[model samples]
Target: MDVTVIWAAIIALGVLLYVVLDGFDLGIGIVFPLFPDEDERDLMMNTVAPVWDGNETWLVLGGAGLFAVFPVVYSTVLSALYLPLVFMLACLIFRGVSFEIRAKANRTKHLWDLAFIGGSTGAAFFQGIALGAFLQGIPMDGGRFAGDAFGWLTPFSLLSGFGLVATYALLGCCWLVAKTEGDLQRRLRKLVWPLTVMLLGFIALVSLWTPLQDPAIAERWFRSGLFWRLAPVPMLVLACAAWMRWAVHARHHRTPFIAAIGLVLLGYAGLLVSLWPYAIPQGLTLWEAAAPRESQMFTLAGAAFILPIILAYTMLGYWVFRGKVRHGDTHHYH
Candidate 1:
């Protein structure tokens, strides 16, 4: 197989992992305002505190893979998204600091809580904006970003931001339903239907908007035989949504979370199918953006060894922290 395709797959896997793993934690922050009770907030934070940082490992891996395997693409995207990217980093830093300091100072806990909410909102919004901008295609001249600093701002990008916020919030709500017990779980159960309905609406909006944004995408999706073959992607996602709604209503603890995760995975797969071969939407192919074969091979060698270790550690962490977080469990990370 070509090294470019190999690295692309690796990068895709890393990205998928990051979105699913870190997504629910970010969602927790998004839904923070819903649970005004300090005890409930603590329990919610406790559910994610141990695994949150570990969940970001895939993000680091994905970024590094992009840099190593597609240096030109990395540079172009960063240049194109300089401001949003910087803001995202700041948001992530603020969010991480809140986790540490919120536990230290009683009086300043409220401030930290605000930071967590703001940071998560900023991070998720900008990420979705970036995704929308990328899908619409970045302006490029000779493989370099040619657009102004505010080129990424558009109506579609803004809508994408809100959509992602809803997606993450849904994931967070489902996660709470799974990990928590008693009144907290019951409250989360009440939220599931609304969040799921909102998510389905966003999915519908994106589904309508995607093909319309680009003729190539429209042709690939609606004008080809592939459309019929790939129709099951959205169908499966809808099924997951239905299953999650039922599971939450039925009070099947783990099933709702699993179904929510499956929904995200299916949505991501659909996006990838719509954007294959192109590294930067309509701008460049994977072969064009990829580093030289020698460079790719060298990085591939290191990634081959390192990725498994990361995967094993991730699995071990989940296993060690397995099972429901009982009410008043002091074993949770503070």
Candidate 2:
């Protein structure tokens, strides 16, 4: 068995879990301004409070796993994208602080609210920028990053940033639909169709624009035999969008969220399809960038042991918190 491939799969799973789990909460912050009432905002915040921090565990796992198993890629990519990564972390810190302190603040509550919104939006935007930069391929020399500090800021990256913001907003809206009721839920449901439309627009733009930016990617999708095999991905995305719209129109709360997740997974799958075999896009293959086989084997054993424990606790947290968050329900934050 290829232990490198195993480790790569593990890390991919971790990243996907992080994006899906944390994306919605960050999205809640993205759409916070739409619902101006303090009580409504509180209810929105409460829906995610118990599990928001926990969702970030996957990010730590993904990052640490990359550093351990693919140190070369980790070092090179981090160095290339240092500025944006730091900005993303700063946003996350402010978002977390605002998450915890927003409930307690009286006079400055609005400030925290703004922080939450700004932090979430900034973090999501930067993440997409980093992704676009990575996808467009990092410049490398002798297995080291050979890119400018501001290379990540580009038209494609900017488009990707806005795309992710819309994606998260849609995810957050679907989540609220399942987790709240009455006027807030109704308003949230109303937002769902438009958010879905907006997300689809961004997805289409990214899908077309990425190929234009990188001819190799275009060749891989078009001239290569890979096109027929990967055809279902876009079809599935359309199906998920249709299902989400129908669910919202039918007033079926949970189905829309499930469909939203389906859309995310399909989009993620398309990305993986676009950049398979290469750990650092056009720069380095996974095998070339991987740590020593012995090191990967050792780390895999530990990850194998720990992954289940993390999965167990995550499942437990969600199960325990399952149910609609009502307006007057007493929360731990209070």
Residue-level lDDT tens digits of model 1 in 1-334: 6989999999999988888888899999999998888778888888888899999899899889999889888999999888878888899899999988887769888999999999888888888888888888888998789999999898888888888888888888888888998988998988988988898898899989988888989999999898998888878987888898789778898888888888788888888988998999889999999988999999999998999999999999888887788656734676
Report backbone clashes per prediction.
Answer: 0, 0
RMSD of each: 1.1, 0.9
lDDT of each: 0.87, 0.92
Cα lDDT for residue 139, candidate 2: 95
Error of 1 at 158 (Å): 0.9
lDDT of 1 at 75: 93
Clashing pairs in 1: none
* Sliding window of 10 residues with minimal summed lDDT for model 1: 325-334
> What global local distance difference test value does model 2 have?
0.92
Deviating ranges (above 4 Å) for candidate 1:
none
- Kindly give the stretch of ten consecutive residues in candidate 2 with the minimal lDDT sum: 325-334
Can you write out model 2's per-residue Cα lDDT over 1-334, one digit (the tens) per residue? 9999999999999989988999999999999999999999999999999899999999999999999999998999899899989999999999999988999899999999999999999999999999988998999998888889999999999899899999888888899999999988999999999999999999999999988999888999999899999888888889888898889889997999899999889889999888889998888889999999999999999998999999999999899989999977837535
